[model samples]
Target: MDLGGNRRGVDMGPYAVRASGLYGMLKDLGHSVTDGGNIPVPVPEEIGVGA
Candidate 1:
């Protein structure tokens, strides 16, 4: 979710976390996994000056 810095694919954070098996692990531990889905993100061009 970081911007204005290194372009190391920070936008893929959610995918990476999911791919890490976190949800599966939690479910294996008998916990319910509720995926709230991705957050709303503004494209870089949508940022205003000094924002």
Candidate 2:
């Protein structure tokens, strides 16, 4: 969510990992993968400071 941070794009991490074939790689190693999906989080702009 990048709360209390100056940088951006931290929220894109999950998408990046999925695009890198993490699911397939783990499955190949005998692990069961389940896509729990993304949780809903409000952006900093939506909630405002100290919200």
Best by lDDT: 1
Once fitted onto the true fold, the runs of candidate 2 whose alpha carbons sit more than 4 angstroms away are: 4-7, 43-51
- TM match of model 1 to true structure: 0.50
Tens-place lDDT per residue, model 2, 1-51, is 556757798877778879999999999999999877888877657896777
lDDT of 1 by residue, 1-51 (tens): 666758788878779879999989999999999878888868879899899
Provide the RMSD of all predictions against the true structure, rounded to 1 decimal. 3.4, 3.5
For model 1, state the Cα shift of residue 43 in Å. Answer: 3.7
Q: Relative to the unseen true structure, what is the C-alpha lDDT of residue 49 in candidate 1, on a scale of 0 to 100?
A: 89
True-vs-predicted CA distance for residue 12, candidate 2, Å: 1.1
Cα deviation in Å at residue 7, candidate 1? 12
What value does the lDDT take at residue 34 in candidate 2?
A: 85
